[model samples]
Target: MQLLLPSDVVRKMRKHMFRAQRREIGGMIMGEQIADQQFRILDFSVDATSGTRSKFVRDAEQHDLVLKEFFERTGKEYHRFNYLGEWHTHPGFSVDPSLQDIYAMQDLVDGTGGVDFAVLLISRLRWFWQYDCSASLFLRDHQPVRVNIKREDPNAKTEGEL
Candidate 1:
């Protein structure tokens, strides 16, 4: 299924990935959409101190703190933004949601009503994966619909802009 994200948001995500590559590290952000489906990216956060080998550590207390602070600071930026969820990366392979990922997803579901969001995974193979969706009883927990993407060709510029 095709994802219905705003064109501007997609562009910014692409741009962020490029920057992440330059620093040899992964990045993450939070976003939300109103009931009408209008998307707003609230804030971008990352553990820049960690690199490709960044451990997918499973620390409940630490995770809670991160999520809490994230919400407290930026939850009010949008008319309807909440702790919509997080994004992270993988050193290799497609950024498929792993088992640990599912657990984290479940935490979000239990903590916040039942909101869906995006998770981005950048691969060392020069590809990126985007997962977007919500949680449901019939669906697997933290299941993200993946969108494989390619960058705009610089040589084939669009319209009057670069």
Candidate 2:
């Protein structure tokens, strides 16, 4: 699957990551599925002060609120726009998913929550506004697969331009 990260979302994530300094921060990723096996990340919750230097546990309640708000704003469309997955900052560490990250995503998809698959995006600020990131798709009874991520062009007038 391919994940499209909009420039605005990237900027918001970078701002939160920089403000968090060495600590990790994260939240839910909400977006729309534009085509087969393609998803666009439109917005994400910013968790600025709820993590340590090496660990981040998102506030489920806060993220739920964000999701609900998105749903309301989108006219409660379930298939067109919904929860995609999660994202978190790794700060000084590599962007690769830790063992814990893998297990968490696996549990999420495999659980009775009705999610057949989920994406985990791990990222860290490299320097200035530059970032190193990895996106992995977790499926039930399957290994995590590396997902291709394309950054959306801010000036693009249409999806074809991306």
Candidate 3:
């Protein structure tokens, strides 16, 4: 399975990553899940919070409301969009999943019944979070799935450019 993230959304994440700098900041990815093979991330939510340098906990309090707002702002075609999953930054480190990361993914999957799939997007950034962030994706308990931010982005090049 693969995920498609649009260019604007990628840019937004990069901006957030830069602002967070050495701290962890995260949000939810909102989009439609197409069949069992492809998913599209059309929008996101960045809840303002003072995250720590090592961990980020999404503000679930604002998650649903933010999603509803996005759903209304977009064309009717995106009304069916649901929670795709979460994304966080791992500043100056590999995007590999830590043991805690794995458990958090598992916990999310378990908390939501019928969620056959879930996403955990980890991005490793350079100094000052400049340049395109190194990204890794995990779908459910599966191995890391490569993220194709967008075909149009010149910096979409990565290990798995699917």
Best by lDDT: 2
What's the C-alpha lDDT at position 54 in model 3?
84
lDDT of each: 0.45, 0.88, 0.67
Q: Could you give candidate 1's per-residue lDDT for residues 1-162 as a string of tens digits?
A: 221244454455555555555333433345555446434444544554444444443333545566567667764555455443455555443445666665655555555535444444433325453422222121235454554232333354542211
Ranking of all candidate structures by their TM-score, best first? 2, 3, 1
Tell me which residue pairs clash in candidate 1. Answer: none
User: How well is each residue in 93-151 modelled by candidate 2, as lDDT tens digits?
Assistant: 88889999998899899985569888999989887578778899998899999999987
lDDT of 2 at 82: 91
Error at 146, model 3, angstroms: 6.4
Ranking by lDDT: 2, 3, 1
Off by over 4 Å in 3: 34-36, 74-80, 112-114, 129-162
Clashes of each: 0, 0, 0
lDDT of 3 by residue, 53-90 (tens): 88788777787788788777765454357767777877
Off by more than 4 A, model 1? 1-28, 32-38, 51-54, 57-79, 111-162
Q: For all the candidates, what are their Cα RMSDs to the real structure?
A: 7.4, 2.5, 4.0
Return whichever of 1 and 2 wins on TM-score: 2
Each prediction's TM-score versus the true structure: 0.46, 0.93, 0.75
Residue 10 of model 1: what lDDT?
46
